[model samples]
Structure formats: C-alpha cells, structure tokens
Target: MLTSIQNPLVQKFRRLQNAKERRETQLFLLEGTHLIQEACAVNYPLMTVCYTSKWEEHHPELRSIVLENCDRVELVSDEVIKSIATTVNPDGIVAIAPRLAQKKPPIPAKLTIVLSTIQDPGNLGTIIRTAAAAGADGLWVSQDSVDLDNPKVLRASAGQWFRLAMGVSDNLHELVTSYQQQGVQIVSTTSHTQTSYWDVNLTKPTLILLGNEGAGLSDDLAALADLQVKIPMETGVESLNVATAAALMLYEVRRQRS
Candidate 1:
C-alpha cells in the first residue's frame, strides 16, 4: 500500500485540488464512492483510482469494476487518502477523470439555462441538480463562473453533473442573441418586473437567464431578455437565493408544459 504522502502518484492527486492544476491537466478529482459509481454508470473515463485498504474491503464489487476499467488503481493508506482528498472526512475512494469536452454545434435544447458570473459552487451544483430533475434540456454557464468541475460542485450535484448537458460561454450576449434568432424566448427574472413567472409562455423553445448571487444579472444581459418576469413574494423581500429562484423558474416551465 502507498503509505507516504510524498509518493509521486499521491502528490499528483494532491495537485488536482487546485483549479490551475485541474485546468492545465484537464482532469478533476472525484471524491467518495458515490461519485465514482455515478461516473462508472455513465461510462465516464477514469484514469486512476485510489482507496484505503478498508475501503476496498468494504467495496469488493466496486473494486472489481474499477480494476477492470481504470487505467491504474492503487491501494493507499488512509492517511495518504486524507492528504489527497479535499474533504475533511472522505468516504475513502477517489478517482481522476478527464474534463468533459464542450459539445460543438451546441444542442438546440428547448429549455436551456444560461448563467452569468455564478461564483458559488454549491449554488451552481444545486441549480444543475434541479435542472436535471425538472427535465430542462441543458445548461450554459459563463466561462468566468466557478469551474463547472469544482469538487464541491460535483459533490453537491450528487452526480447529476454527468447526466446534464452543459457548456461554458465566453460571450453570453452572443449566445443569447443567437438563441433569440432561432426563435427561442429569453427569460429573465427581477423584482422590478411586473409580469409573473407563471404568466410567461415557457412551452416554446426558451433560455432561462440567471445571474451572479450578489449583483444579479448585468443590465445589458437583462435588457436582452425577450421577457422579464417576477416571482411573487411578500412585501419586504429583496430577492431569492439564485438556486431557489432557479428552482422556481425551472419548475414553472415544467408546470407550464405539463
């Protein structure tokens, strides 16, 4: 068993914790047995997997599967696993997988989410999970937002990240404009808007626009929306959490089409 944190492979896994290393390598770490199982379910390629001896003993079936599929599998000491993992108390298994490449000629999804400057990893992951559950077609995140492959985002997604079709947009305006040209309605939400979210005809091809948590959508992006609607709230509320607002809007679309 690899016991030393100084082991080359263990050190390499440790480097994956940084965003820069992840970007340069085009690989990210998947912590816990659940995330690995989820990846395997989708046939996501795994380069390497490491686990404590205790973990391997408890997960015999999973060990066999990974042994067959992964290019390399290592039995490491718990201390080494802890050093390589981001979580304080990891579930004892981790895998390294290459980043999902963007789909060229983006899928012409009927209900796509467009997010700008969404910095919170947890919120982004929650939105992804909700979008997948609500049957939204896909999602487009601004390139400047939190890395879609952030470890927290992955864990928060509960593995829906693999199932959902997503891409990053460097120029959101161009993306929104293109969608509009295709006859897709661009929807935005704001407290200032009078139109209720339910009143919007979301059955048509649509792109839902969400913004940063603190500042909200940029005025230029908001102005591009074909429709601006509001979630009805009590008198004193300023706004909703981005993820909560996303759930309301996505499900509203689901409700309208159902």
Candidate 2:
C-alpha cells in the first residue's frame, strides 16, 4: 500500500496534466477503471498504471490485465490520485497511455471526414466518436488539431478511437484532390454559403471538411469543396459549433445516401 502523495510516480502524473508537458512528452493521462480496462481489451499498450489501495479489489479486470500484461503498476494513496487528474472525480486510478498511430483511410471513395486545425480536444474527440457512430469510412486529423491522446479527448471519445480508422496528416488538400479525381464530391460546411445542406446530393462519394470553431474554413480547403453548404438556422444564431455542424452535415449526408 503506497501511502505517500509525493512519490516520484505521482509527480510524473502531475506533470503530464499540463498541456505543455503532454505536448513535449507526447503522452496524456487516462483516469478511470473502465478506461484502463478498455485500453487493455484493445491492446492499446499501457506503459504505467497507478491506482489507489483498493483498485485491484474494485476492478478484477483491471487487476488481471495489469498483472498479466502491463509493464508496471504503482499503488498510491487516494489523495495522490486526485492530485493528478483534471476531472472533479478521479476514479482512484490513472494510466499513462502511449499515443497509438491512427489508421489510414480504408476506402478513399467512401464518405470521409476531414478536420482542420481544430484546437479543442473535446470537439475533436466528439467528432471522431460521431464519425465512428455515423459509419464514416475514415477520418483525417490535421496537424494543427488538438492532440488525440490528450486526456480530455480520450475521455470524450469513450474508446471510439480504438475502432475507427484515422490518420494524422498535413496534406488534406492532396487527399481531397485525389478523392475528387475519383468522383468523390468534397463538401465543406460554411456559414457564408446559401445552399441548404439537405438539397445537396450526398448519395455519391463525399468528403466533409470541418474547420475551426471561430474560423469556418481555410481558403484552400474551402476552394476545394465542390459545394459549400450551410445548415439553415433560426435567426438568433449565426452558426453552430463546429462539432454540431459536422454532426448535422454527416446526418444530412447519411439521410440522403439512404
């Protein structure tokens, strides 16, 4: 039973909570008994596991995974576990998970979701989760987008990242161009465009581009969109959250395709 709160392992966890440290180290903290179990279930390659005194008793699956496959396990005090988490409730356990390489797009001809420089980890994770749910062929994570392994992203995604085929690339334009050549229509969401999203034909091949929350779309990406579209909104609101916009566009496309 590790009683001290100032252990070296605890300090490392504390450091990784910072955005700068996470970026520098390319690692994020995942806190939750089930999340740890999910990672092990998917063979996500756990580097370290830290938990309070009762972790093993509380979660047999986690204990089994840790004892059988994990490289290291550090037992710490409940107070120590709380110090390293970003959430209000720490769940008495946390793990340092290595960032897995995202899979490349499987079928370039199918519906593709392209996210450009989306800085919010929560939005990016939610988009990925939505993409997985919407049955998109694959997803693109632009270089400027938030770190996929960031704790907030992992928590928001709810383990969807393990199943979806995703890629981190800087050449979204090139991919869009290639898909276009193959008869795929690239649709970019924009508040400026007048075309109703439903009217567009999404039954054919498509690539949907979502831009930053404040900035709708980059000029280059927007130029590539075969048709720029807008989700008709009530008068009070000018636009939707980028994730919301993407979800709306994805739903419209799916509705038309069916």
Candidate 3:
C-alpha cells in the first residue's frame, strides 16, 4: 500500500486540485466512492485509482470491477487519501480521468439548456443533474462559465455528469443563432418579461437560455431569444437562484411534453 504522502503518484493526484495543473495536464480528480462508481458505470476511462484497505474490504465486488477495468489501481493509506481528496471526510476512494476532447455542440432536440457566464460550480452541477432528470437532450455552457470538471460540480451532479451530453460554446450568440437557423426556438428568461414560462410551447425543439446569478443574461445574448418568458414569483421575491430557475424551467418543458 502507498502510505507515504511523498510518493510521486500521491503528489501528482494532489496537484490535480489546481485548475492550472488540471488544464495543463488534461486530467481531473474524482473524489469519493459514489463518483468513482458513477465513473465506472459509464466506463469513463480510469487512469489511476487510490483506495484504502478498509474501503476495499467493504466493497469487494466494486474492487473486483475496478481491478478488472481501471488501468492502474493502488491501495493507499487514509492520510494519503485525505491528501489527494478535496472532501473534508472522504470515503477512501478517488480516481483520475482524462478530460474529454472537444466535441460539436449537442443538437437541440427536445430541450437544451444554454447558459452564459454561470460562475457557481454548485449551481452548474445542480442544473446538469436537473436537466438530465427532466429529460433534456443536452447542455451548452458559455466558455466563461465555471469549469465543467470542477470537483464540486462533479460531486453536486451526483453522477449525472457522466450521463449528460454537454459542450462549452466559445460564442453563445452565434451558437444560439445556429440553433435558430435549425428551427429550434431560443427561449430566454427574465423578471421583466410579461410572458409566463408555461405560455410558451416547449414541446418543440428548443434552447433555454439562462445567465449569471447576479447579472442575469447579457443584453446581446438575450436579444437572440425567439421568445422571452418569466417564472411567476411572489411580490417580495426579486429573483430565484439560477439552479432553481433551471429546475423549474426544465420540468416545465417536461410537463408540457408529457
């Protein structure tokens, strides 16, 4: 077992926590048993896996699977696991996987959530989970948004991160325009809009545009929307959280199509 924190592999895993290191190396860490299981379920390539003897003892079947599938596996000490993981109390398992190669934007089928400058990792993760649950076809995030592979975002996704098809767009306005050309309706949300979210026909191929938590949508991006809709709120309420609004809007599409 790898017990020493000074080991080269342990140090490499610890370095992955930094965004710059992750970007340069094209590898990210997946902490906890659940994220590792989720990664296995999707057959996400596991480059290296470190787990404590206690974890292996309790999860023999999972260990067997990991041994069979992962490229490299190691038994590590608790201190080593803690050093490599971001969680306050890790479940004694973590993994490393290569960042996905750039792919074409998801085709706007039934629903696609288009986000611009969403900075919060938790909010983005929640939105991803909700979109997958609501049967949305895919997700498109602005390049300026939080990194999709942020450890917090991955954990908050509860494994849905692997199941969902997502892409980051360099130019959101142009991407929206492309979707519009394909006859996909672009919908934007705002407090000022008179049109209620439910009034729109979400059953058609659509792209739902959301924006930053505090700033909301950029004016030029908002102008690309074929329709502007609002979620009804109590008089005292100024706005809803970006993730909550995403859940409401996505489920509304699910509700309409059902």
**Reference-based lDDT, each prediction:** 0.91, 0.81, 0.91
Q: What is the TM-score of each candidate against the true structure?
A: 0.97, 0.91, 0.97
lDDT of 1 by residue, 1-258 (tens): 899999999999999999999999999999999989998888898999999988988999988889888999999999999999999999899889998684533445689999999999999999999999999888889999999999999999999988888888899999989988888899999888789999879999888999999999999999999899999999898889999999999998998899
Measured with C-alpha atoms, the lDDT of residue 72 in candidate 3 is: 96
The segments of candidate 1 whose C-alpha lies over 4 angstroms from its true place after superposition are 102-107
- Candidate 3 wrong stretches, greater than 4 Å: 102-105
Candidate 1 minimal-lDDT segment of 10 residues: 100-109
Give, for candidate 3, the lowest lDDT window spanning 10 residues.
Answer: 101-110
Off by over 4 Å in 2: none
Q: 1-258 in candidate 3: lDDT tens per residue?
A: 999999999999999999889989999999888888888898888899999999999999989888988899999999999999999999989999899873444664768899999999999999999999998888999999999999999999999999888998899988889889888999989888789999989989989999999999999999999899999998999999999999999999999999
Q: Which structure is stronger by lDDT: 1 or 2?
A: 1
